[model samples]
Target: MDTDAYTTMRFERRGQILTVFFRDPAEANTSDLAIHEEVGRLFHDLREEREARAIVLTGSGPAFFTGLKDPVGSLLWQREQGLPVIDAGRQVARRIVWDLLDVEIPLVAALNGDATGLGATIALFCDAIFMADTATVADPHVRIGVVAGDGGAAIWPMVMGPALAKRYLLTGDPVTASEAAHLGLVTHVCPVGEVLPAATAFARRLAAGAPLAVRYTKMAVNRLLKDTMAGAIEQGLAHELLTFTSEDMVEALTAARDGRTPAFHGR
Candidate 1:
């Protein structure tokens, strides 16, 4: 496969296992507007790689992946520049995640460090998620006055059940690797250095397994996830975007920038 074609993500292949490291050497993996566009198309492109029977998806750097580069700045820039917030926000939260769910191949996520917001959502979508012993996961959309529309609403319930999902989503609290494993949210939790190797071994095993059986088994199980996404994503994204124009969102962003607690008026 031509790894150079993807700028935001680095792709490498070893035998039948295709590893997609989230970003290049210079920058940490961030779910900014740029990476949002890259992820939307990567899975579709990977489907054509006949040699790739299984894929390992991981981030390069200290942090596995965090939320947007600057949620406050991005929204403010859109407003200042007279760009459409709803359209752009929906593209990242709804469309990109929707496309990632359609990838047929088995995906292994090696979480080397913290994963927040959309980063957590991306990890949750993978077939097998192995977190570093110290890694943590959280989706803090509510913290910034936005709905968890980026696959959080769809996938969280399936993995952790509705009650636990609601608690985490409502509070926007961090779930440590131990807590995640305890809650049955991740496949395994290993030392930071062991995460990649363990994930690679799992991917290689899947790659060497029966191709048709493996693919079809994954497809069969993901139907539930697909159905849930189809039902919730559109409405969730629409509501999230609507929140973007609210006084609370403005207050949240301003407070974040200025380093103060926002006193929301519930507008």
Candidate 2:
């Protein structure tokens, strides 16, 4: 694959293992529409890269991923410009989840730091997750007046069951690495600074195994996720986009700008 073609992420290849680092550490790897679109396309490209037997995904800085960059501002801008936020959102959301699942190679997440909102969803979707002890994870879309769409509503429930998933998703609370492991949301929890090494080692081990067996096993297990995503993601993203136009969303953005708690009236 042409790694240079990517701008938001950097890729390094070591034998059959590919390590993908989310760039933009200055922004704590926060993703915008451009980054989201790039990520979706990257996964589709990975699916065709036969040389990469395993993939390790991690961030370049203190944050593994921090969700969207200025999502409220972006939404308001889209509204001001009379852009089709819903239409664009649906396409991006669907492509991200679908292309990620379509990758047959084993993918492992190295949670070097906090993973929130879309970040949490992507980390949890991996075949194995290695989270740093100091890192936290959450799907906190509701905190910003958005639904936990973008695979969060679908993947979180599958990872930790609907009951526990709702507890965090509804409140937009952060989960510690230990708590995440206990909930089966993480496969391993390493001390800070060791997450990537452990995850890479694990990925190498998987790469050494019979490639066909590993890939087929992952495909078989992912069937449940794909099915759940099919049923939930579209509706979740639709509702999320609808919330972008809500009065409550405007209030949320205003509160965030003023550094205060949002007073949501559920409008």
Candidate 3:
């Protein structure tokens, strides 16, 4: 695959197995606006990747993916500049999930470290997730004063069921690798430093499988996810956009910046 167009992510191909790394290790591979846009386009472009039969996605450093880069600051800046933050965010968020679902090849996630918010959602969307024993995952959009609308609301319930999904989503609590494994959230949990190797091995196995069978099977299974997303994504993102302009969101951002607890008054 020609991966020179991507900057936030690096790609390595070994035969038919491709490993894609989140490149900004110093920042824990947090997705900024550029990263978000690039990721969506990357997945969209992968539809034409005839060489790679399976892909392994992992981070370069101590995080699989953290979330957004300075989301609070970015939101504040957009508001101050009178930008149409909601429409812009809605477009990016929708494209990421849709493009990811459209990929025909299997996607395996190697959670090398903590994955929070949108990071957790992306991992959950994968065909299989291999997480480090020391790692944790959580969709904490609610904690940051927004709904878990960016594929989180749709995928979490499907992976862990509604009750268990609500427990995490409602509280924004992190689930340890062991806990996630027990709950059937992650496919495998490896010891520290082994996550990538384990995921790569699995992806190689997938790559060696009957290509048409594997691809078609994945397509069949993903139909359920697509249906759920079709139902929930629009409303979830719309609600999240509304929360961006909420008083509670502003207070949450301000309190986080000030190193204090936010006093939300349900505005």
Best by the TM-score measure: 3
- Give the per-residue lDDT of model 1 (tens digit) for 8-126: 77878898889988763336354456666666667667666677888998888776777456678877665565437557767756656755666777889999988888789889988
What TM-score does candidate 2 reach? 0.94
- Model 1 compared with the native: what TM-score? 0.92
**Which is better, 1 or 2, measured by TM-score?**
2
Worst 10 residues of 1 by lDDT: 23-32
Q: Candidate 2 — which residues are off by over 4 angstroms? A: 25-31
lDDT of 1 at 30: 48
What is candidate 1's CA lDDT for residue 259? 99
lDDT of 2 by residue, 1-267 (tens): 788888788889999999999875356454467777787688889888889899999998778977466766766665555547556866777787888898999999999999987788889889999999999998878887888878899888887889998999999999999999999999999998789999999999999999999999999988877876677888888888777677887788778888899999989
Our model 2 lands, by Cα RMSD against the true structure, at: 1.9
